[model samples]
Target: MPIESPSRRHVLQASLTVASSALFARAGAQGLTGPAYEVSPWPGPLTAFSLVDTSGKTWRPADFKGRAVLLNFWASWCEPCRAEMPTLQQMADLYGPEQLLVLAINFKEAPARALQFAKRTGITLPVLLDVDGQAARRWGVKVFPTTLAIDRHGQPRLRVQGEMDWTGKAAEKLIASLL
Candidate 1:
């Protein structure tokens, strides 16, 4: 019998499982009956990013300085991501781009596939391509459908892991705080 080291993939998977379980447990303990938005006040400025959307427009955090930004990291294969997308679009419509900008960052997916999903779902939100997943990695997005809410001054306010109804009361409250 030989002692073998765990592979990198196994280690990463185990880490993610533990993290997700802990997050859910914390949410339950907090009596979070509404949407689970983990209040994460960033100690510093917003994370720097430069990504291109499906329409080939380069976007950066500074580009949307005066408006609250919702950065959603999603993939076409994620069912929850697919389900929550429409609500995100609705939120964008409700607030308008001047007040709130919702950018859908596709995780490690092809631009064509993401564009197809947007077209099929009739989503009008700008779909940014994270082809190398660097943006997600930079933002520390380990879970699928993680959304970070940034305030008008380009500061991160809260992070929500998993799917959430953007039209719900809790979501409205969160959005209100950002705006």
Candidate 2:
């Protein structure tokens, strides 16, 4: 039986707008933006560790500065990891070293096994060796094929667990947004 005041209506509208924006931002950060990723908002310093590739060159998270890094922890025995290798390789080629660096870190596996898997899969991406499981422990990797998307500043941003279609449109859009 009474009309609402102008100030009250303005406040309600503003509150609704803010709420909607927050919801969308949270959803986008969580890889729910129509992408095949399972993103989680991980805004923190990356776990520190040092690992080498087949060439014996040491690598750290900080070494990937100035470019987004896709640090994937996987094992040769993981079927999902093997299944995702080609798509990962394709993504690596698409982004290249200047934009996105895809690091396929073999989890506690022998160099021979890692090399053999890469060879078999024709994976051209740079493969890092998580020898002795030190790096895996530091990164808190409990599952196979865990992919962490790190920003250019060496900060962990998004984490995608399980396998994914990295070559799909949703993935491309998400990576492009990061770039």
Best by TM-score: 1
Residues 1-179, candidate 2: write the lDDT tens digits.
77989999999999999999999999988767763436666564586777889768888876887999888999988888888889988998987888899999999889988988888888877789987987777767777788888877666788777788899876787587567
- How accurate locally is residue 143 in candidate 2, as Cα lDDT from 0 to 100? 72
Clashing pairs in 2: none
Off by over 4 Å in 2: 1-37
Q: Please list the residue runs of candidate 1 whose C-alpha ends up more than 4 Å from where it truly belongs after superposition.
A: 1-45
Q: Please give the lDDT score at residue 17 for candidate 2.
A: 100
TM-score of each: 0.78, 0.75
* TM-score (C-alpha, index-matched) for candidate 2: 0.75
lDDT winner among the candidates?
1
Q: Where does the lowest 10-residue lDDT sum fall in candidate 2?
A: 35-44
